[model samples]
Target: MNFPIIHTNFWDAVIAIPIIMIITQLTKLIYHTPSKFVPTIALFFGLFISIFISHRHDLLAGVLMGWFYGYAAIGNYAALKTAIKSYRNANK
Candidate 1:
C-alpha cells in the first residue's frame, strides 16, 4: 500500500486545529449544541477543513490528518477547561 506523503505545514499546526476548535465552540454557542455532540461537531469541522482545504489532493492523508486535527482540538479544549476549573477552584 502506498501512503501519501502528508506534509504538516504551518497551516496544520498553527491554524487548522484552532480554527476547528473555535468553529466548534461557536456552533455550540450559536445553536446551543449539547456538550455530548461537541466533539463530533469538532470532528466534522476538522474533516471538512482538512479534506477540502488543507489536504485537498490526497484523500488518505486528509482522513488521517483530519482525525488528528479533531482529536487534538478535543484534547486541547478538555485540558483548557480542566486547567481553568482548577484555577478557579484554587482562587476560590
Candidate 2:
C-alpha cells in the first residue's frame, strides 16, 4: 500500500494558515452565519466541488459547481438560523 507523505515545513504552515483564514472569512461572509461553523461547512463544500471538478474535468461543470456551492452555503445558513430560533422559542 502506498501512503501519502505529509510534510511539516515552515513555509507550508505559513501558506496554509492564511489560506485557511481566508476561506473561513469568505464562508462567513457568503453564508452570513456564525464564524464557528464557517470553516467546517466551507471545507465540506469545497471538498465536494473539488472532487466533482476533478472527476468531470469540465469547465462548465466547474462554473456550475461554484454556483451550487454558494447556493447551498446560503441555504445552510438560513436553515441554521431558523433552527436556532425554533430551539430558542421552544426552550422559552
Candidate 3:
C-alpha cells in the first residue's frame, strides 16, 4: 500500500490548529461535552477538516495532520485553562 506524502507546515500550527480548536471549543460549549470526550471531538474535527477542507486528496496526510490539529487544539485549550486558573487564584 502506498502512503500518501505528508508535510507539516506553518499553516498547520498557526492557522489550521487554532481554527479547529475554536470550532471544537465552541462545539463543546454548545454540547456541554464531557472532559473525557473533548479530545475525541477535537480529533474528529481535525479529521473532518483534513478530509473535506485542507488535504482532501491525501488521505494519510490528512489523517496524520488531523491528529496534530486535534492534539494541538487540546494543548492550546489546556494551556489557556491553566493560565486562567492561575490568574484567578492569584487574584483571589
Candidate 1 lDDT score relative to the true structure: 0.90
Off by over 4 Å in 3: 1-4
Ranking by lDDT: 1, 3, 2
RMSD of each: 0.9, 10.8, 2.0
The clash count of every prediction, one per candidate, is 0, 0, 0
Tens-place lDDT digits, model 3, residues 1-92? 97777766787578888888888889889999888998899889988887777788888888888887888888889999999999999999
* Candidate that beats the other on TM-score, 1 or 2, i.e. the better one: 1
Question: For model 3, what is the alpha-carbon lDDT of residue 38?
Answer: 84
lDDT of 1 by residue, 18-79 (tens): 89889999999899989999999999988888899988998899999998899999999999
Those runs of model 1 whose alpha carbons end farther than 4 Å from true positions after fitting are none
lDDT of 2 by residue, 12-92 (tens): 334433444456567678779776666466555544553354324654544444444544555555687799999999999
Model 3, residue 54: distance off in Å is 1.4
Give the true-structure RMSD of model 1. Answer: 0.9
- Clash-forming residue pairs, model 1: none
| TM-scores of all predicted structures | 0.94, 0.42, 0.83
